[model samples]
Target: MRFTSHTTSADGITERDFVHDGVPGVLWTPGHDPAGLVLSAHGGGRHKRAPGILARAHRCAAAGLAVVALDAPGHGDRVRTAEDERFAIEIRSRMAAGQDAGALVAEYNALQASRAIPEWRSVLDALPALGDRVGFWGVSMGSALGIPLVAAEPRVRAAVFGLIGATGPLVRAAAAITVPVRFLLQCDDRLVARDAGLALFDAFAAPRKSLHANPGGHGDVPEHELAGAVTFLAG
Candidate 1:
């Protein structure tokens, strides 16, 4: 299926391979200040181009926020082996484990356990500017990666976690983050349940933060969340 995309931002998208400290991933720059950045990780079985990824990145960049969305080590441009060979090996094996949300959850868990968060920190270390005035906006797995990175680094000024909540490994580390945060929810969603996110929100120590329920189902939430983030980060 073909996904629709457009490039209207004054700062159009620039695709490049960035390798820092042995970790490599494609970086999509939506055109904003290099000093202030937003790093994203897509949901499972997804890439940086997943449904709302790039467009939202573009919107954020248009809004004066530099946006960076990276593919997980095995997804999108980061696929380990040639498509045929890579899928023949990993796909057959991983699918036998059951290819569903449960499987995705397991994969997400394993990625966390294997220290993906530290790899992101390594990316920040590699790019000095990536550490400045950064606010994080992550979808499903992106939230997982952002939570720990933000907590471990004081530079993340504010964050918006889309399709996520206060549970999971990311949420487990939220308490360590003293910065402001925001969460989006779809009342009828199945990916990341509304209730779980609520539990997680209540757990965060951010003196300032709240949840917004969009009128849609799972996946991309619209502008209100970002507007709240601007206020949080600006303060």
Candidate 2:
């Protein structure tokens, strides 16, 4: 990774911005020695700097865990193509029609993973080793990409994911993830059906997995719930 710049947060966290093979990312480290490393991913249409993702990074750093977040394919500083724009348009149109865009969404997500998952692996390879234990934190689109990542990368010791339903081959991927999981679900998620999300959670092969469900729409996750995720990752 190419180190560009770094600044210290008022809270004593050092935030470093860098690039890896053209993908932009940020890494956060606490003032003292870190417990481990956590890789974070942002939702669709959002870059590595999304507030929720940064907030989670800060929380994790506060607990002495190093955090890394990368801009996914077609997001942040990555170059976009006409095909990418077309795909975005299609997603918007499909959602507006109130159609079950799961198939289309799944296809796009899988394609994104073709680049994103490898990018993550490369980041893991390129970044300076922070610790032996690694965790993953992702939500919505982030979760969509992360499930497969957690399943494939054994270095990822645990995960906090959910918000999108089972899509494409993720069902099979979910079955392979044996790490402990903290899966979040929203009862009235406007974008993802509750049953579909539950189905994905049920597919997890991990013997230790917990589903934390709350009543509200897609982005209505309570702050306490996030704290719970931080506790799980920190532990």
Candidate 3:
């Protein structure tokens, strides 16, 4: 990992920008030693520094946990490939025609994960600054990627995942994850069927897991749930 810039905020949180094997990422830390490390993944089409991600990072940092976020392939500074462009156009067309685009999204997410999981593992290998405890926070497309990562990575002890449904591969991945999980579901998410999301939650093999469902669309996760996640990941 190569650090490109570093800055400290008035509240004693330090932020750093870095590039690892061509992947652009950001890290935020409290001035003091962090109790643990949290890897944050942003929603599809959103970059590492999306408003919601930044809010969560700052809050986690204040709670003495270091937070790291990476711009997923075809997002932020990364160049989109022909496949990515094609998927974008197709999904837009399907949505405009009021057709179900879930399968397209699932396939796209799987492709992204094949590339992203290795990048995340490489970043973890380089980040010796992280303590023993590691957790993951991601939703929507983030969850699509994260479920597989946390399943394969024994280093990750806990996770926050949701805003996604039980695609076949994801359900299999979720079955492999035994870490405590906190899942958030938007009750009225237009993109994800409510029953599908519930089924995904049920697929997790973790002995300790909780589902938080609130009334809203995909983007409207309740504020309290955000606060609760900070507490959950911190502990």
Candidate 4:
């Protein structure tokens, strides 16, 4: 990883911007020794530094956990391909028309995960001393990619995934994961059916997994849940 810029906040957190094999990313570290490392994946249509990701990074850093977020394929600084553009348009049109876009989303997520999973593994390889306590945090599109990553990468010991349903290849991937998992489900999420989310949670192979379901839409995750996630990953 090549660091492009470095800055420290008043709160004693150091932020570094880096690029690894053309993938742009940000890493946040506390001034003191970190509790562990957490890899954060942003939601659909959001980049590595999306507001939610930034907030989580800061919170995790403050809790003595180093955090890193990278732009997925066709997101952030990466150039979007024609296929990416077409998928975006189609999904939006389907949603606007009140049509189910699950199939389209599933296919697109598979493609993105094919590219993203390797990129995340490469990022882990490039970083020094991640140890065995690495954790993953992602929802929605993040879960689309993250489930497969945590399944394939042995380095990731725990994960928090949600805002997505059990679909396509994700179910099989979820079955492959054995790490402790914390899954969040928005009870009234319009994008993902509640039954599908519950099915996904049930598919996890982890012996120790918990589901936290709240009454809200996709983006209405309660602030208290966010605080709880910080505590979970900081352990």
Best by lDDT: 3
lDDT of 1 by residue, 117-142 (tens): 67666665655654377777775667
Stretches of candidate 4 above 4 Å error?
Answer: none
Q: Give a tens-digit lDDT track for model 4, residues 1-235.
A: 9999999999999999999999999999999888789999998899999999999999999998999999999999999999999999999999999999988998999999998999999998986575557999999999999999999999898999998999858999999999899999998899899999999999999999999999999999999899999888877
Predicted model with the maximum TM-score? 3
Q: Let me know the TM-score candidate 4 reaches against the reference structure.
A: 0.98
lDDT of 3 by residue, 101-148 (tens): 999999999998898999998888888778978999999999989999
In order, candidate lDDTs are 0.62, 0.89, 0.95, 0.92
Q: Give the TM-score of candidate 3.
A: 0.99
Total clashing pairs in model 3: 0
The C-alpha TM-scores of every prediction are 0.73, 0.97, 0.99, 0.98
Worst 10 residues of 3 by lDDT: 123-132
TM-score for model 1? 0.73
Residue pairs of candidate 4 with colliding backbone atoms: none
User: lDDT of candidate 2?
Assistant: 0.89
